[model samples]
Target: MSPDVTAFGPDFPFGYDKWLGHPAGLGTIPAEKHGAKVAVIGAGMAGIVAGYELMRMGLHPVFYEPGRIGGRLRSEPFTGQTDIVAELGGMRFPTSSRAFYHYVKKLGLETRPFPNPLTEAAGSTVIEIEGQKHYAERLEDLPPLYREVAEAYDAALEEGARFSDLKAAIAARDVARIKEIWDPLVDAWDERTFYDFVVSSEAFRKLSFHHREVFGQVGFGTGGWDSDFPNSMLEILRVNLTELDDNQRFIVGGADQVPKGLWAHAPAGPMHWSPGTSLKTLNAGAPRPGAARLFREGERIGVTDVWGHTELYDAAVVTCQSWLLTTAIDTEEALFSPKLWMALDRTRYMQSSKTFVMTDRAFWRNRDAEGREVMSMTLTDRLTRGTYLLDQGEGRPGVMCLTYSWMTDALKMLPLPVEKRVALALSALEKIYPDVDIRSHIIGDPITVSWEADPNFLGAFKGALPGHYRYNHRMYRHFMQGEMPRHERGVFLAGDDVSWTPGWVEGAVSTALNAVWGVMRHLGGRTERVNPGPGDMWDELGPVRLGE
Candidate 1:
């Protein structure tokens, strides 16, 4: 059962990639149910993916979106530049996200290794802490303190989570071994914080407070994870075990293309629709207005758009941030059990802000007097937590993500305008590279996004807190509705927030596939014998349940 290091769950280890790639074609719906209308709320990645699959299965999926199509996979182009754009959200896609890559390949989209901190793709990295800066092309180039911190984290993993053995089981797709090791971890770490894990570890206990602080700032994989210090250790462990933060890449043109492509693409051979039928054509080109209300109207689900146009459907798939269910939409109380509602309402979303500027050229690639890059990928403790340089090409204008910050750091810029945000970021970077003038190279109106400020998205994505494993478990497995009361059967939840690995696009895609299965099954459809869907394997491979 050796599979790719995919999003195959440390929780629900269902191979969504396998189900998608199978020749069986995601199962078949009864001919009678072919044209059944299924309301898909939110036109984000999860919504678009679920809508696309349901459309292929012969069901008519009506989309409702408050904002743009891509959702969190936003690629905001600089003024007057299409190809050169800023990835506002969900920018980095790890190689382990096999399910997500499946669509990237399907759309023939080009991807390049994301310039992560210390990765060769970044060319070079600069770590700055407390007004002290250290430049390095690799880990070894830094001082011994950096190496010791790295080694301490590695040792801590081996000590705390059986890192090596669990990762091996995951890569091997050994479901039994994965559960045997990971299930118990749910109970052990679900109540603890990531900060607690490091402080409690023998490796970090021996090191000074500075080492732990360094580990949080210039953390492994992307950048500072200090924002996630208060999050559950189980969340961080899932990321480590699945390699969600390693070997990442970004779509060449824009990540927005993936969801837009899925929306416009005509599957090779769809179920009941004509050969040229697509989600774009089915709903008369654009999606309905944002879903303002969700309720069950006499066995069928009803979704009322903002414009007051209500539509009834046999089933509905909700892919928006869970908070919307309570805040934005008037979701009927009877639609879900009290426990499920608590999970949905209590789900915590983290704040994130990214400010990107289009440069006149790839001037950062220029060398300084010391023959080093003038400006390298930066990780600092300043207001700008992480800064990435996006080199378009030698002659082409480059997109510079001047600052990417999360949680408290993100909230700092939430109230500031784009100009102020850019100015603040420049002020911070000026201290690190005093000689290089970043503002001088700026070419276009700088773009920025504080996801929390956007009414459509309350926050960037879910960041599970301690003791919230039960909440996550309830939401992630809500797709399996066999035993649920009939009143709650018609509507299903799908989104990154509804998954164990929130904030990762892979989780969004995986959960959407689950909702597709749930919708299919609700519509009286079943997968072929050769390819069992997630629902079909639920009892055998569901996520480990934590006792109350």
Candidate 2:
């Protein structure tokens, strides 16, 4: 008899690492296939994690990175500073990213609470809108209208989707309850934008657009969720239902450490590698040249790098943004079916921009004449949509993320140089705290990133638009190509874009593990007698296929 998923109760299959160790975890490859090589393109979180784990299982996983190892998780230190650094991508992470955190904890990295607005770490927040400022130590201190918006959001969630019950079902791994709640939601909300959900809800409809505007400007959890308003409502619901935006924390030194650490970490008692082998030591301190072309060669796959050096591998995992397949590389016509190619071509990426400067110290923490700090975690309607302050230590130097923006807000700053971006942000902040001298405290040159402007990455991350659920479902389920023809079995897609929650690292890790399972199966692996892979239980717990 199949194991009863309901018996697991509250112990869901979401734990990627746990799933690996579970009786029903990934299947194992036979010893004869253990030493076969695997090619992993892109050195991002998904690539690093998947490669490391595969290496532990006795597979020789070679990586191809056009640039640095930490793809989008870039943390740049000041030129002359000892430890002060600016986060150019993925600054904060929520605790719910358990799969990603598994490696973080294993590597023994320290993390501190991120100062999201209304959180205690924030100390205070200034919400600026409509040329007015309101300072609050907590959410309750905000205007009654703001509170009403917050309450209305909760009521809408409860009324429209049985939020509490769905959450309970998810927590319990109650697959039946989950499908009953989620399948219907996917069918109803797949064609609806987040803006539509917010405006059409009975609770939000009762209030004027002013309340909606306030909610847009100063959203709960993370500030200014308006950038996501135009995307699918299912996207928003997935984020909230999974709590991807809550309980966030910053890696103490840098978020890039997650990927960097994985590259050098030696898992305890790894199979074929020596006791101290790492991805770095395994590759002789360098990655294979960047993959420039990919195609099928008989039963195996071939990848040719920029230098025209070609190598054949038993299986390949593509972890970069999917568009690069067509734009940056020479891909064969038959490698991916037309439908899959369409999904890759149609992937919509959201734009993002961030400007940062190293400060002499956490000077913003200094008390003013009125016995209040000069500034706090700030959210505003101005060009600098969100500002975050990072405290390095009590008296040591620190970093300030002057402006982190998305969507149209991100597009507006795309053309500006770093110095001008910093200047523009300072000008906006000056209006909120006319008393604070933001320019005088800067100790180093400013740093900035417009992800959309980066060549290797065309955009920050994927944001599913309304009617894009089918595309996402198709991309995410591509890892299950073992059931496809032999030619398609050797190539796997793994990345945040190929995940349900496109922007969250958890999704990246989850999808990468799925690809690992797919690779194992393709290479003639089998689960232990008692253990079964996710594919073994697809009907009970697989993602709902709407309109199928």
Candidate 3:
């Protein structure tokens, strides 16, 4: 029997590894350029994937990370606890993010369906707003008012955006069709906020402000998307159409394992190094010091480490957050155009906070007097906002993400310590399940994170405001700098923030690959007959810039 290729999906989208293995994908560089060194900043998934692929193409990529290799793919396990964790950063990923799954499958990693509200894995859900509680196993179980609002949302998506058609076009890689559908929407919604899109729509107009408020508090997929209300409609569409908010799964151990695995993985072929040599071995098991400054000297780009040591590299891919260029690092003004710098400076990020706890077991699984789990994956208008439960199985320790909030909600918990945050979350949760003593089941100290408090990352991820597409277009296309004037050819940007879908790992991985393509060209290489990079399909697949 033929192998099941279903996980790869039906449209047979861009084959990342297949493209690499193809003859057309091979030998992009001149023989003399083999093993030439390139600088890769940030050891996140983007940097790691780019470095890994560059190594396969016979280039040596030295990575520099200020902290750990995972970047925002951080999974914090409780102290002395195994099989339980708090996902402090990017957690769930959709299957449609194929490029990301390619690495996951290659590393022999396991994944389980994320317990998103209303999904089968979610079991049940509780949506509480204004002191009224509604429990359901499905959307239909909600009050008629909510059902009307849900129907309106579905209708609006169909009539206003042609959502299903757009999703299909993207799935098929029918770039022309995608552009045909997406371009007009960008023109229509680029200057509008998600809230504007909803209120102005025929469906939402008929609904009451209270209905709108309920929808804002407990959205269908992963609690409220209201944090995204202030962002451009185009941003929301990119997320929804690409399935970033649906059919998701969590990496079995930890999401960070993906990048960590790639760092140590040894490719098989003429990599110009030993057969079993890996990035870990090549870097001598340590990353270069964090870069404190970057500037163009004579021909190559000069990078200064935090220790004030400076070195020059032929090319550099900066996967760090854009704000660092101005705030955390001293980058030469001449490296990027004034326009590009403006875009980087204008990039806005959303603040996010999460509080998680380790429990002895899946205590929530314990049946109540009514013969149901005491609690469900929760969504509420209260301070806690959203809560998710994770089961490690019958006997192993389980984890509960007590609260996940963004923007104003996140800022509220910023000043509090971890214990206080956990206490506040429990106090709020107790109101919903008054009979249950949530604090009693805890097995270890709670873990909490306020991304805005972290110096390395000023915020969680980019949350593009209305009229921000031009800025995004500039940043996303920074990899095309080889085509720019001589002064702007070396420094390239790649990260989730620079991608169209911020906070999604697929964006990070895809944009990183885009940077790899750019770096190859910068190093005097070109794609062969069939394995063309994103630039080759630029006209069809390029982002829809505002006022284009």
Highest TM-score scorer: 1
Rate residue 542 of model 3 by lDDT: 64
**TM-score order of candidates, top first:** 1, 2, 3
lDDT of 3: 0.83
Query: lDDT tens digits, residues 365-463, model 2?
Result: 888887777899899999999999888988788788999999899999999888889889999999999989888888878889999888789999999
Q: What is the lDDT of residue 294 in candidate 1?
A: 97
lDDT of 1 at 452: 92
On lDDT, the leading prediction is 1
TM-score, one value per model: 0.99, 0.96, 0.95
What is the C-alpha local distance difference test score of candidate 2? Answer: 0.83
Report the poorest 10 consecutive residues by lDDT, candidate 2.
1-10
- RMSD, every candidate, angstroms: 1.3, 3.4, 3.0
User: Could you tell me which residue pairs clash in candidate 3?
Assistant: none
Model 3 lDDT at residue 487 = 88
C-alpha local distance difference test of each model? 0.92, 0.83, 0.83
Task: State residue 487's C-alpha deviation in candidate 3, in Å.
Answer: 0.9
Which candidate, 1 or 2, has the higher TM-score? 1
